[model samples]
Target chain A: MLLQIIVNGILKGGLYALMALGMSLIWGVMDIINIAHGAFIMLGAYCTYWLFNLWGVDPFISLFLSIIFMFIIGYGIQRYLINLVIRATIFITLILAFGIEIFINNLALVMWTADVRKVQVPYGASNFSIGCVTIPYVRLGAFFIALVIALVFYFVLNKTRTGRSIRATAQDLDAARLVGVDVAKTYALTFGMGVGAAGAAGTLWAVLFPINPMMGGILTLKSFVVVIIGGLGTMFGPIIGGLTLGVAEALGSNWFGTTYENFISFTILVLVLIFLPKGILGKSE
Target chain B: MAQRGATTKKLILGILIIAGIAIPFFSGNFIIRFFTNTLMFAVLASAWNIIGGYTGYASFGNVVFLGIGAYVSAVLMEKGGVPFWLAFPASGFGAAIFAVLIGLPVLRLKGHYFAIATLGVAEAMKALVDNLEITEGNSGIYLPMMNLSVKAQYIFFYFMMMGVLTLTLVVTYIMLKKKLGYGLIAIREDEEAANSLGVNATLFKVTSFALSGFFSGLAGSLYAFQQGFIKPESVFDVGVTVKMIVMAVFGGIGSLLGPLLGALSIEVISEILTNYFLVAHTLFFGAIVILAIVFTPKGIMDIISGRKKFGINYLLQNIRDHRV
Candidate 1:
């Protein structure tokens, strides 16, 4: 039973890492919280849902399209709306993100009434047994996909010129500007990249869990927990944070019941803020 | 000249107070209900201004106090047979106690961390409330129905809420003019500097948070009594936080009249939008907030008070300052 719970947690953590990656990246690069992130994830889920329901496009195949589409939307939002208040006070930027979140969430509600949806496929229920342990195929597949994406994202960040520019901008905006970097463009790009990741996570989530327009709130909170736990800016932070949270949540639910999942996550967040404000892997200023 | 100006201001204030007191007599039941709700929003927004605007903590979980207040009053009235008058202030005390405890640790966090931590706490509180037996769990608690007629009930709650609003405004006005207010403003401008100046930053922040919680809790209690029902979702809704924040930001942050004007105007706009668009009301509200934040971060109060000259140039200057 313990092994089963651990395995389940690790798999769930994989998806959590993906969701947190974008949020942490945006925060690291632009200092914006992007409160509407979960809404973008919701939009991605709908995209996959519609693709599967209307045209029989597999969720795995539609993930690419959703990422691209969400990237554009995210880029546009940062460039046009968020950029206007990016240099304002922390309160202003935070409130602006919140406004966008409300807009997207309500727009979703109007476009598609509050109905829970999920994608169904032939192998969605299939599982493989190794010894006494049972591994679900869908979750295992999602886990592998999430791992590959994380690795790819890390490689791009470390190996590419654009990635270097993004890192430079994250570290020092004025310095990057002195080096002829378009800080504004980099911010927009970083935001778009983060949203694209959220889109990918949403596509996977649609296959594994029930979804609706309002599903973003808890997911957004969960991502924050992961980001805070994993430490900001570091590539491996989200992965570590996500795994810790997933295991903690799994154990918490097992012992305390499902209602306490939020309780457990929030407790960890508060404790981390109080005891380890810089996060586990975050470098002290 | 200054004395005459003060007298004229006092005269205007006196007239406004008389009109506010007599509003229920002349207004219809619907209008009374509307004003009561708006005044409650005003109280909440003003309370938020204490911590969020003045202290710069920007807490997103203040609705937790509202939830606590509602539950405390509801539980008292339902299980203990306490009267509404006693239950209301008791609820405020309950929230104040919780705020002091929670504020001690979380208030140490700065900037976005503090904001997110507060939000996380609020979500945790909601979940905890959902499972607790004393709050009746998810099924929620229903207060005993009042024996008064519908009009009387409306008028009673209206007056109760108005009284709460008056108390909140008076307290805030006095605080803003006193040492505590200056300390809070200094902390917002620079916490370390405030501390260096012997402002007792932590004490001021916690006190502001507690005061904010106190009024929010009272509003919640009044809300519970008016509705005759209390649920975790209704009282602890994030939407309540959003509305309070938006209204506070819309009118002006940290000013006495900002939240009052914000709450009244936003509520009016919300009512009008809800009537016409129904499903699209939230969308419009969100759009308006975004536009307002982008174009006028200082809020409408700045223009009304003539702190910033109102014209097309003002809008252009805002865009130039913020735009990349």
Candidate 2:
């Protein structure tokens, strides 16, 4: 039973890691907390749901479509709206993200209503057992996809020219601008890419669980916990943070009931903020 | 010229106060109730101003204090048979105590970390309240209905909320006018400099936090009594915190009159929008928030006070100043 719980937690953590990576990237690079990160995730899930439900397109296939669509929207938002406040106090940017979240959430509610949705493939419920462990295909597929995406993201950041420019902009805005990097365009691109990751995660999420407009609020909070735990800026931070939170939440829910599960992450967040502001893997100041 | 300008400012303020005081008598029940609700939020936003505006800590969890106040008062009245008058102030004290206990560690965090930590604490408190038996868990506690006419009851609660608003404004005014107020703003401007100048940052922060808590608690108590229902979710709702912050930011952070104006305007607009837009009102509200933040980052108070010019040029200037 313990082994199964751990397995479930690890599987659950993978999706969380995927979600956190986007938020962490945006925060690490832009120094702005995108409070609307989960709203973008919600939008991606909706995209996947519509493509699957209407056209019978598989969620995995629709993932690319969702990412492309979300990238455009994300890019536009940053270019037109968020860019206006990026250079102000961090508080202004935070609140700007909040306004965008409120906008998207309410718009979703108006368009889609508050109904819950899920993507059900033929083998959604099918599971395989091996040596006293059971693995669901959806969960497994989602985990590996998340892992691959994180790996690819890390590699692109380290190896690619665009990645180098992003890193440069994140490090020093003036220096990057002096080098003809077009800091505004880079910020918008970074935001778009970060949100594209959210879209990908959301596509997988829709396959595994229910989706709704209100789902973003809790997901956003959970993503924050994951990012804070894993440490911001570092490549593997979300994976570590997500897994830690997943296991802690799983154990906490099992022992104290599901109502207390939320407390575990929040408690960890407070403790981390107070005791280890840099996080386990974050750089020391 | 300076003396005449000060006299005119004071005269306008005096007239505004008198008009506000006499409003309840002239207004009907619906308007009074609406005004009361706005006043309650004004108190909350004012409390937020003490820490968020003056001291530069953007707390996203002041609702926790509101929740604490509501639960404390409701429990006292329901279980201990305390009167509403006693329970109200008791709630404020309860929230203040909780703030002191948590503020010691939380105040040490700066910027976004501090904001998120307070948010975590608020959520944790809500979860804790959801589990505890004394608070009756999620089923919530209902107060005994007051034996008074409905109109009388509305009038009474209106006065109660008005009194709370007055207390908040007076406290905020004193905090800003006194040396302690300067210390708060000094810390906001540069905490390191404030510390170098021998301003005890930690104590002042905690004190401001507790003061913020006290008003939130008082507002919560009044809210519970006005509604006669106390749910952990309703009292500790994140929406309340969002509204307070939005109003404070909308009006003008770090100003005494800012929260009051912000609260009144937003509340009135929302009330009117609810009648027309129904479900879409919040969407429009969100859009307005974005536009407001983008165009008037400093706030409407700046324009009203002549610190910022009112025109397309002002908006363009704000965009230019803040854009990448």
> Each prediction's DockQ?
0.76, 0.82
Q: Of the candidates shown, which would achieve the greatest DockQ relative to the real structure? A: 2
- Deviation (Å) of B294 in candidate 2: 0.2
With candidate 2 superimposed using the best TM-score fit, by how many Å does residue B229's alpha carbon deviate from the native? Answer: 0.8
lDDT (10s digit) by residue, model 1, range B1-324: 445545644664587588778999999999999999999999999999999998999998899899999999999999999998799999999999999999999999999999888988888888889889888988989997888999999999999988888898899889989999999999999999999999998899999999999999999999998888878888988879988998999988987778888898899999999999989999999898898898888877676665556798998788778766
Number of clashing pairs, model 2? 0
Residue A194 CA error for candidate 2 (Å)?
1.4
Q: Note the Cα lDDT for every prediction shown.
A: 0.89, 0.89
In candidate 1, stretches whose alpha carbon ends up further than 4 angstroms from where it belongs are B1-19
- Candidate 1 clash pair list: none
Name the docking class for model 2.
high
For each candidate, what TM-score against the reference? 0.97, 0.97
| Model 2 chain A weakest 10-residue run by lDDT | A89-98
